[model samples]
Target: MKKNNNKLLGVVATVVMAIVSLIALFPIISIVLSSFIPSGSLMRNGISFSFPWDELTLSNYTYIFTQSAEYWTWYGNSLWISALMIVLSLFFSSMVGYALAMYDFKGSNIFFVAVVFILMVPFEILMLPLFRLMMDMMLIDTYLGVILPGIVAPVAVFFFRQYALGLPKELMDAARIDGSTEYGIFFKIMLPLMGPSLAAMAILQGLGSWNNFLWPLLVLRSNDMFTLPLGLATLLTPYGNNYDVLIAGSVMTIIPIVILFIFFQRYFISGLTVGGVKG
Candidate 1:
C-alpha cells in the first residue's frame, strides 16, 4: 500500500512538472517556429498554431550575418561589454563584500546601510543624472561611458557581502598568521572559496548588461555603437511590422544567452543557492 502510494505521488509530480515546462517553453517554441516561416506567409497566416507547412529558410540568418555587418558588430559589442562588466563587477564587488564581511572599521554600519539603501533606488530614476554626468565627462557614445556606470552596481556588492559573511573568519586569521597581507589573503584564499557567489554574480551582471536596452539606447547615438538589444530594436520598421525579421533578430539575440546559461547552469544554480541560503 505504501509503495503504491509513493509511486502514484511520483507519477503525479512528474506530470505536473511536464505541464509547467510546456507552459514555459510555449513562447520560445512559437518564436522559433515563426522565425522559420516566410515573411509573406507570416502576414497571410498571422501567427498560426500549426507548424510551418513551408520549408524553413536560412535567409533571415544569412541576411543578418552577411548582408548586415552592423548586426555582427552590435552582437560583438554586446558580448564584449557584458563580459567586461562581469569581470569588473566580480573584482569590485568581491573587494567591497570582503571588506564589509571581514573588517571592523569606522562607519562600517553606516556604509553597509548606504549600500543597501542604494539597492532600493531604481536605475530608471538615476538615468537622467547619470547621462548628464557621462556628458560632463565627455564619455557619451563611448564604451567607457556605458561600462563605467555598470561596474558600481549595488546588488553585486550585496550578494558578495552576504556570501562573504558566511565564510569562516578563522580562515582569514590563519592567512594573517602565515604572513599574508590583506590583499594576498583575499585574492589567494578567500576568492577561491567565493566561486559560487562570483559565478552567480557573473551570470546576473552579464545578463543585465546584455539585455540592457534603455541605457545603451540613450548613450549610444550612432548605429555603429549599438548593442544587440538596441540593434534588434532598430529592426522594427517605421510601419510597425517585419515580424519575420524581428523574430529572427530576437532569436539571434537570445541564442548567446541561452548557450551561456546552458554551459554555466550548474555553477549558476550552485551560486544562487549558496548566496540565498547563506544570506
Candidate 2:
C-alpha cells in the first residue's frame, strides 16, 4: 500500500512538472513559430500563436543571414560585453563576498550594510550619476563605459557573500597553516568550493548584460555600437516596421542565454537555495 501511494505521488509530481514546463515553453515555441510567419500577417495581427502553417516561410531568417551584417556586429558586441562583464563580476564580487564572509575587520559589517543598502537601491536611480561619471572619465561611447559599471554588481556581491557563509572555513585555516597566502587560500581552496555560486552568478549576470537595454542605450550613441536589444528596437518606426528581422533577431538573441543556462543549470538551483536569506 505504501509503495503504491509513493508511486502515485511520483506520477502526480511528474504530471505537474510537465504542465509547468509546457506553460514555460509556450512563449518560446510561439516566438519560433511566429518567426517563420510573414511580416504582413504579424502587422495585421500582432503577436498571436494561432499558427498559420500554410503561410510560414524562412525569409525572416534568410534576411538576417544575407542582408544584415549590422545585426551580426550588434550581436558580437553584446556577446563580448556580456562575456567580459560576467568574468570581471564573478572574480571581483566573489572576492568581496569572501572578504565579508571570512574576514574580521573594523567597519566590515558596516561596509556590508552599505552593500545591502546599495543593492536595495535601483540602478535607474544610479544611472544619472554613473553617466555623468562616465562622461568625466571620457569612457562614453566606448565598451569600457558599458562594461565598467556591471563588473562589480552589488547583487552579485550580496549573493556571493550569502553563498560564502555556507562554506567551511577550516579549509582556509588549514591552507593558511600550511603557508598558503591569503590570495592562494582564496584562489585555491575557496574558489573551487564556491563553484555553484560562481556558475549561478555567471548565468544571472551574463543574461543581465546581454538583455540590458536602458544602460546601454544611455551610453552607446552610435548605431554601430548597438547591442542586440538596442539594435532590434531600432527596427521599429512611425512608418512600417521590420517585423521579420525583429522576430528573427530576437530569436537569435535567446540562443546564447539558453546555452549559458544549459551549461550552468546544475549549479543554478543549489546556489540559489544556499544564497537565500531566512527570517
Candidate 3:
C-alpha cells in the first residue's frame, strides 16, 4: 500500500510540473513562432491555433542584421552600457558589502537600514529628480548618464552583504595579521573568495542595464546612442506597422540575455538564493 501511494504521488507531481512548464513556455513559444510567420499572414490571421507553421521565413532576422544598421548600433550600445554597469556595480557593491560585513562602527545598523530603504524606494519616484540632476551635471544624452545611475543598485549591495556575511572572519583577520593593507586584503583575498556573489550580482546588474528602457529613453535623444530596447521601439512607426521587423528586434533583444543566463545560470541561482536567505 505504501509503495503504491508513493508511486501515485510521484506521477501526480510529474504531471503538475509538466503542466507548469508548458504554461511558462507558452508565451516564449508563441513569440518565436510569430517571428517566423510572414507579415502578410500575421495581418490576415492573428496568432492562432490555425496559423500556418509550414510557411516560416527568416527574412525578419536577415533584415534586422543586414538591412538595419540602427539595430546593430543599438545592440552594440546596449552591450557596452550593460558591461560598464556590471563592472561598476560589482566593484562598488562588493566594497560596500565588505565594509558593512567586516566593519564594526557606530550607526552600522542605521547604515544597513538605509541600504534596505533604498531597496524599498521605487525607481519611478527618483526618475524625475534623477533626470533633473543629470541635466544639471550635463550627463543627459551621454552613455555615462545612463550607465552611472545603475552602478550601485541597492539590490546589488544587499546581495553582496548577504554573501559577505557567510564569509569566515578568520580569513580577514589572518590577512590583517600578515600585515596586508586593507586595500590589499580586499582586492587580493576578499574579492577572489566572493566570486559566486559577484557573478550573481553581475548577471542581475547586466540584465537590468540591458533591459533599461525608460531611463535611457528619457536621457538619450540621439539616435546613435540609443540602446537595443529603445532602438527596437523605434522600429515600430507611430502611424504604421512593421510586425516582422518588430518581432525580429524583440528576438534580438532577448538573445543576449538568454545566452547570459544559460552561461551563468549556476552563479545566478546561487546568488539569488543566498540573497534571499540572508535578507
lDDT of each: 0.82, 0.85, 0.82
Residue 70, model 2: Cα distance from true site in angstroms: 0.8
Per-residue accuracy of model 1 over 37-119 as CA lDDT, tens digit each: 67667667666787776667877666656667777788789989999999998899889988988899999999989876887
Give each prediction's root-mean-square deviation over alpha carbons: 2.5, 3.1, 2.1
lDDT of 3 at 50: 80
Off by over 4 Å in 3: 237-240, 271-275
Residue 123's lDDT within candidate 3 is 87
Candidate 2 lDDT, 203-257, residue by residue in tens:
7787778889999999999999999989988987544467778888888888656
Candidates ranked, most accurate by TM-score first = 3, 1, 2
| Model 1: pairs clashing at backbone N, Cα or C within 3 Å | none
- Among the numbered candidates, top TM-score falls to 3
| TM-score list, all predictions | 0.88, 0.86, 0.91
Model 1, residue 92: C-alpha shift (Å): 0.7
- Which candidate leads in lDDT? 2
Number of colliding residue pairs in each model: 0, 0, 0
Reference-based lDDT, residue 76, model 3: 90
